[model samples]
Target chain A: MDADLHPERGMFLHRLNPVAKLLVFSCFILAATLYLDVAVPLTFLVLAWLMGWLGARISPFALLRRLSPVLAAAVGLTVFNTLFYGGPREHLILTLGPLSIWREGLQIGGSIGLRILCVASYSVLYMWTTEPSRLVASLMQQARMPYRLAYAVLAAYRFLPILQRELGHIQAAQQVRSAHRRQRGSWLRRITHYGIPLLVSGIRQAERLAIAMDARGFGALPTRTHYVRTHMRPLDYIFTATGLAACALVLFALGELGLLRSFLAGVAESLAGAPQ
Target chain B: MAQERLDLGLARWTTREIIVMAVISVALGLIFMAYGVLYLALVPLLGQVGIMLLLGFYYLTGILVPYIVRRPGAALVSSFLAAFTELLAGSPFGIAAVWAGLAQGAGAEVAFALRGWRDYRLPVLMGAAVLSGVFGYVYEYFLLSYAVLEPTVQLGLFLVRIPSAIVLAGWLGKVLGDGLARTGVLRGLAITRSAS
Candidate 1:
């Protein structure tokens, strides 16, 4: 809802069409998934942060604050991969009683962790800058998504806050009725008790809303005109071209230096060879 | 309330059907966002398997929507909407959530597709959940680099995820569908029409 209401600050990224932004980000994400090396994703991570700060005009502190939770999760991933690493125990990093951390484990874990960060950073920037209304507009007009489905999604997006408020009311009413009088129930039980009422109220409201929409001939036309049209501009093309060129150049350099490790290649070797 | 004739043919969805599924999916999306955070916290103890065990929640919309709506692509649409909602709400996983949603939804839909999109019986629902778990695992195998992990660990993940999918998504979806049908709010919906 907040994203829907976000005033376009007229930043470069904000001015670009959502479709262009999606193309550029998807390019980077696809690159991250293809390569398994640490340097590749590390390069992408830095590039993503730089774009967020300079392109989107997002303050570094604000970006870091938003990324803190993801940072923590990334670190957790690193630790998990290191501890449970089933790879060959080569280039010992450290050792404890029956527990050891190896270079191979750390590399695999760190690469995956950094990849997650890279993807998250791009997505955060895009989500922060793009308006939901414009996103649907671009999706319908540029992405060729059917208007009916797109509008259905937009209608659902609008109902989120209402649903949250309804949830609060359900919890309060149940609490007053001494639903927690005895031992507290499991989280599953509690959610179910609250979920049913929430679902019923939401369904009833949705049905009423649907009838109102139908009355207004919401789906009468296959293609409808938009008040604010989202179109691809020259600047959007430049941005996409520049973003993609930078990624390709980086990958090219990495490949020449023999630092580029293809993920599929690694998987093939791992599967073909026995556990070390 | 008069029982409307159940139209099991692959007809175009009405506005009512679309809106109803969206609302339900969005609600589930909100709940799953909480679980996603809890998943990150539990990684230290349970490792990646923690996510696998908690995966049934992710598969819920995929199963629930098709069970109630019984329409072609209902599973995929609702599941995708739920994930997209999580993305808009700023889930920690960001864009990856959308891809996971697509894969899982497609997997769940396969069961109904095999059943010719008609059966809403318990077995088909559970089968949908299992197929979704399978697809989720396969997607993560490449994206999350699960291929690099020890084969046994990968096996462990597969073993834990199936049952979790069954109990959490399949059985729970049935319960929720039955509960909503009982409330009479689902009167004009396909699930109620078929029952009556």
Candidate 2:
């Protein structure tokens, strides 16, 4: 899956251990969830974008273009919250028959929207920086994940493009066999029929892979030597420290803005609510 | 060794089972990419009112992996890997996609664990799917801000999505599992005597 993306060479993120990058990404998202206020998350979003621009070596304009679909989701969810959340009807900004949008609804919607933008960037950046082989290798060397599982995962990661190609072949075969009836059915038919042939081919290939790996003495040892050692270097620690300090700074800022409990409670309460 | 391997109670993942997990996840990951296009088109059109309509497409790896692999933690790895696949394939949901995967994986993992990882029957598997739906639903509830909606609207969304889960991930997952089983594709791999 990391086959297509080539991170700019010698960039700070590309040099960081894949595990460090993943940890930073995970911590960023987890911390971003702490606030219901827009500023905190929106700040995080801008910070993430800046990290992409400055550290990951991505162009800001191109990054935004790539993230536009995610931004669209933020817009969709925000619109939904504004219209249907329906808080204190008197604060209504607009009304269409039974549908109403309130000021509070907009605020709440915007917070979620900002969170969406803030959260999605973590994955984008992580995927951008970390190669899949490096990720699995890091998991093995740093986290002490069993090499059996790690190499198996690497092998599986290589299966993605093959599966995609096989899927195209299956559809083409089906098209030749049933050209007239193909377009008439639901996507369910197309997907379901497509899944079987792909799966069948997939299982066959998997069995062969398992045998090949075993024959080559894969997973024979509890641990194995690494050709590319993945460890946290000084720069990785700097990246991690910078991420931690940034998180602390955001929380303190949220506290200083005095929008602590009520901000998050509103969201938690909304989620915790169920039909009486 | 074969007998021990066949026992689902043994949480140990063999090379074969790992490959199976990876294979299914990669294939489904491609499907997820396809599904993402359909979802992005529909989400804006339906807005919040139909957000749950896509519920079925989510949480499937949670169901499919455990049934096929019959290992403890298989569901968790499957869902997570599948989510990772979607993320790699450029899912717009991004990190929340991983969040949903983690939550659903944990949920389905619990369901299978309750059966001691020994049960892959249709009922047991479908039950796991529904549980995964419940977990996936809760993640979306906050992540998508359904929590901020009116109580009635929230209930309406929740009610519709659970059944949609029943149809899409639950029923549809079972259909695929059974189809694969009947072809003798999974006969020696899974301990179960009959795919049906």
By DockQ, the best candidate is 2
What are the candidates' interface root-mean-square deviations?
7.5, 5.8
Q: How well is candidate 1 docked (DockQ)?
A: 0.41
- Model 2 chain A TM-score equals 0.86
TM-score of 2: 0.89
Tell how far residue A71 is off in model 1, in angstroms: 1.7
TM-scores, all models, native as reference: 0.93, 0.89
DockQ of 2: 0.44
lDDT of 2 by residue, A30-82 (tens): 66665556676777888888888898778767767877887887898788777
Q: What is the lDDT of every predicted structure here? A: 0.82, 0.73
Fraction of true contacts retained by every candidate, in order, equals 0.55, 0.52
Per-residue C-alpha lDDT of model 1 across residues A183-251, encoded as one tens digit per residue: 276766776788899999888888999999999998676556666577777888898899899889989
Candidate 1 residue pairs that clash: none
Query: In model 1, what lDDT does residue A184 have?
Result: 78
TM-score of chain B of each: 0.91, 0.85
